[model samples]
Target: MSTKEFIKNQVEKFSSHITPEEFADLTEAENSLIILEVPSKDYTLTEIARIIESNNAHVMSLSVLPVSDGSTLLISIKLDISDLTPVLRSFERFNYNVIYYYMKEGEINDIQRERLQELLFYLNM
Candidate 1:
């Protein structure tokens, strides 16, 4: 199977045991996502929306946590499943710190938390 099929299958499997809240978080919208670890700034929201648009995604919701030096932003994006990797590549090229997880997979999963921790350990806490 193609990678997209593999990913969709994996997400489907992961969703099976998820709680209602988690399920809502993951599949509320077909192209929905949660992005975390973005720098805090007055224009951060506008910038994030722009980024999503540039990647051919749409912003649905956003949450923010402020730290001493920067703010972490959680953005919900609506995008095509096939566009995930390319969108991620754009984020990388722009130096936008990003952490993404489906709501279901991210809801209190030790494995998911550990993996994300490993990936973002160096990011400012």
Candidate 2:
């Protein structure tokens, strides 16, 4: 399946327990954010954020999932298309293992965009 389709499926699957409105909110957050599953042993979320920020990217949110060996981090970052390469390279320079799967803001659909706007509105309220 295509990346968008995969993302949609993942969102739907993960949001099943929530109400429709909550699901929409979760989907919007997922769409607007780029998800990075970074293994924790290499770098902490703060270090990753600092590395990205130094390279001119902005991190919006961060979470961690504990695993057996280390941990996995879910990071949402904002970066211009042009800055993607440099930011990725910076991660490599630090020997950070960034998982291949990720979502980009531009990949989100219109419905997701509307949801994102709504979610942002609620956050600002």
* TM-score against native, each model: 0.46, 0.44
For each candidate in turn, give its C-alpha RMSD to the true structure in angstroms. Answer: 13.3, 13.2
lDDT of 1 at 82: 26
lDDT of 2 by residue, 12-124 (tens): 55446664346445544332223455666554657877887786666644444443444554444433332255566677788765554244423235557899999999999
lDDT of each: 0.52, 0.52
At residue 54, candidate 1 shows an lDDT of: 86
* Top TM-score prediction, candidate number: 1
